[model samples]
Target: MQGLVQSVFDKLLPPACPTYTGLLPLITTLLQDRSCFRAALSKGLGLGIVAAAGLIKLPQIVSIVTSRSSAGLSKTTFLVETFGHTYNLAAHVRQGYPPSTYGDFAALLVQNYVLLVLIYAYSGQPALGVSIVVGAVSLLGGMCNSGFPLGLLQTLTAGNVVLVFASRLPQALANYRAGSTGTLSAVTCVGMWLGATARIFTTLTEVDDPSILAGYVAAAVLNGIIAGQVLYYRGIKSRRGTQPSPAKKVQ
Candidate 1:
């Protein structure tokens, strides 16, 4: 197992990469102690899942930026998701979980903020986008210094289960209403579903936190819905293109 992890790391990362530099001793220790190996393996998997979560939104971000159109994207989706990430981070912090466990959520939350702004800007509400960016920065700044209660963090974490589920609804509804999925990347939806599924297993193994598990489950369901939408709409467009128009005579 140690050699497996090391070989995977070596293939994935360059020699000078910090991950390669630091992984040897840790992998060696995991090999020596049976119980320690199991725990460390779980934790390592969990951390990898967390890190992958941070990049799940990249496809969406790229679609919005290079395409310069937030057409099929949902501002509400990212807004609610951002809150979910923030609350999750807060809960983990209150529980005194190692920062590494929650670090990706924090990073992903920032990316979501950028996504929200890009959505607004590309959708022709530049001022609103700018305001949202400023507001988010201010809100984060204020929350950082204020000591948060654990109870509140727990409540927020639990509440996020519902929020995360609802987060994808707006985009799904928009696709339904427009009869198209817009510019929303199918990659983002599929990646999110996969990531959430992986997180559920990793969380159960490593974190064993029910609140977090609940959120991941809810998120996975919604991501599946969005992925379904992507397929459904693609078929709809394809059939439309193939069919003859009513006004035209079939030759």
Candidate 2:
């Protein structure tokens, strides 16, 4: 049985697992000792978040494509949020934080751009979509190869509180006005809310960056607002469905 576990770990785990980067050592020693409990828990949860991130936005994407609508989604919100993630990812990488803490941002970044393009495409703005794709590729490629200043990355990440509001308020306001989240997927909203909250805990455990911690804190609050809207609107829908019909007049 031990050999089976080792075989599976060898095949499934990444090449860096043996490097004693604090994560694998924790896993290996978890039963042998009870030290670093918080670190172990954080690493486990962080990896779970990364694994879940790939499919976190998938339902929303599928819903938009199936309905041919981008009704409740805000393009600007996604665009700005993607920018925030890009800057955060850059900072974490340059600062040499563990990938477990920031890996989800990398995964979510790709998904966000895909969703953004779909939004533009369905909104009849193919040119805008193409422009965004080109801009992101050129900008990120250059930043990666060239010396992306850590100061700028930190500044951008520090401003993520404002970025969070910018990314969520418009969508929340739209939901308020429409009395519905429209085409927004409840699964995605709730998932993101949960993710943000979990990120706050994990960031505290694994990362020492104040900017990243603050961003996750703000994100948790804003994401809760959107998720609350989903539940609130859903309840309203359920109540309306149960409303009694008025009696018809005698003929």
Candidate 3:
């Protein structure tokens, strides 16, 4: 029994042996610049979260592409997601902050772009058109930021949030109830969760603004919700005594 338990523990945990993993260089850099340690750790954590979320969404993307039907998804969610990322990018530029330093914004940019492509291929012209409009807004948002226009960034950010709560969240909830994601990619959802986790830590460590900190806290809560969904779906898949759905099959 002891031997069996030891074997289970070994299987569950990563090997203790250290290798020249990518994080080693990062750790060395942080050690040299102790002052930046918190920020670096936060960023690294955020990146990991984003990566995890992206991986989780793979099944949904595949399902959508293979089925060529978005029967269970909501168009409004994607619409808002596209705009939200663009606005976030614009907000960063307006603040003279590098998007690369902002995990949420960076992840959102990649996620929204991929979402647009997937929607176009799976859902057809209407979805593609909406994506294009959102993409344009995102581009223009950057331009608006170049001049550091007053109120523009705020307006965009506010609009983006409203759309997310009013449209995206509701649609996501509905999709959850449907037991299928329609055309929405599960990998993207997972990526969003991971990104949110990373962003929370990053924001807490990197930024001093009280408002931004509060926002990061809020994002953490949202990420929790997204992660819960992923887990729930996974549980459902497992309960049926069937093979886990491939990430490609989820789209």
Which candidate number would show the highest TM-score if scored against the true structure?
A: 2
List pairs with backbone clashes in candidate 2: none
Clashing pairs in 1: none
| Residue-pair clashes per candidate | 0, 0, 25
Q: Could you tell me the TM-score of candidate 1? A: 0.76
lDDT of 2 at 241: 95
Top-lDDT structure, candidate number = 2
Candidates by lDDT, descending order: 2, 1, 3
Tens digits of per-residue lDDT for model 2, 1-251: 66666665454343333423344663765556444455666777898998899899999999999999998888878888887777777778778877888889888988888898899999999789878967876666555553877788778888878999999889999899999998899999999999999999889887877877888898999999999999999999999999999999999
Superior candidate under TM-score, 1 versus 2: 2
State model 3's lDDT: 0.57
Error of 1 at 134 (Å): 2.5
Residues 1-251 of candidate 3: C-alpha lDDT, one tens digit per residue = 65676565333222222222344553575578654565545555655654554455556667766887666666576666655656666666567653334544545555545555666665567666565766665575565555666476666654543544654476558757877544455565655555655665566565554555555455556546755675676678668777666677465
TM-score of each: 0.76, 0.86, 0.64
Model 2 lDDT-worst window of ten: 12-21
